[model samples]
Target: MIREPTKKKETSVTGCIRCGTCCKKGGPAFHLEDKPLIESGTILAKHLFTIRKGEPAYDNLKGCLLPSATDIIKIKSQKSARTCIFYDEESSRCKIYHKRPVECKALKCWDTREIEAIYDRNRLTRQDLMGDINGLWDLIEDHQERCAYETVLTLVDEIKASKTDPLLEKKALYIIQYDLQIRSSVIKKGNVDSHMIDFLFGRTIFDTLKSLGMNIRRKNGKHLFTTTIPSDPQPT
Candidate 1:
């Protein structure tokens, strides 16, 4: 007896398969076109974070970490994981599928041209969203100035060149402390949401330094650098 021929599985090369690979990598950065979503409260501020200008971040197109030219507001990933906060792992779907941001909409794992074309264009920034808010914008501006990565990186270079210079080390420590202090002040006094701290001031300086291979720890009430700085440090 002849057996029935085996049926081939169906597959498509176009469109998303809901594989969740992109979401698991991390959320997409917000573009200017996505501003309406935030303004309309469809995407709340607490669900997002910022990679401040000059901060080192991974460039999807370039395929390497580099200093960002402008603010890159992105959906926050789940705590202790790179998975996007909006992704529903149980269902393998996006919670805000319909109201997803431009990046999410443009992304097609099968065809990346659309996402790459607009990935780095028209990025939405804190100024665009909150520039009109009195007092708040001023605070954000001040924070950016005080904790600028350019300044911090320069200090790191100086500390590295003069390994035994206490002054250079102290300056770097002070900046880190100030970064931490301002976040606390905003949360307690300004009544800012704790979750917004990362967006407001980027990641903590301690985390940034650690990423650069410098380990910071407190001993006897003094912050000390425990690891030798990398000879050729990348921005991150």
Candidate 2:
């Protein structure tokens, strides 16, 4: 039978040797750019941060976070027995191929130009973080608004989590921030935290933020009037 030529399979990024030089060896500090897919403006890449240091991105003791992605699978480099977290031994490519940070994406065996681009991009990340903080909050608020009152309630629970889980810390921060914003506008009369959160998540943010202080001053003597409707979760 006449022989037919077989086409070569497309190689993914996994084709590289297991040299930790790509990631283990530190380059300029870099951060993941969370740019909006639509915006085309010049982005000053800011560092979100390195996951870990004194070792490769994924892990130090264990080897690369994704060593399986490398062409040369195990950490044969005894000098630095670390492999990449994104390395896939099976396929030999970065797991984060699509979303790898600019530095990782710009890496090349011999291309100095690609290498330079990574450092150039690293210089611009600090400025990137400022807008993201507010933007993420806006996004969270949007989710709460669109999801009805359910999402904000989750925030309340999240705040109550604890020291063991990091979620509670974030939840508390979110609550405080929301309370602050609500208070920034509304000239509230009494207790601000609980009630303001209640209203902000339930009604117009503008109105909630702009509400006049409610039930202010002592009527006869003792208790100061604060507008806090306590949460209704009974002790379990």
The prediction achieving the highest lDDT against the true structure is: 1
RMSD of each: 8.2, 19.7
C-alpha local distance difference test of each model: 0.81, 0.34
lDDT of 2 by residue, 1-236 (tens): 00011122244544456454564433223333534311332322121121111111232223333211111101111134334444555665555566554655555544435544443233332224333666444643453444333343354444333213445434433444554455444435434344323222333322221222122232463223234423343210
Displacement of the residue 168 alpha carbon in candidate 2, Å: 36
**Residue-wise C-alpha lDDT for candidate 1, range 119-222, written one tens digit per residue:** 78999999999999998899889989988989987887787787657788788899888888888999999999998887777788878877775658878966
- Using TM-score, give the best candidate's number: 1
Kindly report which residue stretches of model 1 are placed more than 4 angstroms away from their true locations once superposed. Answer: 1-12, 220-222, 230-236
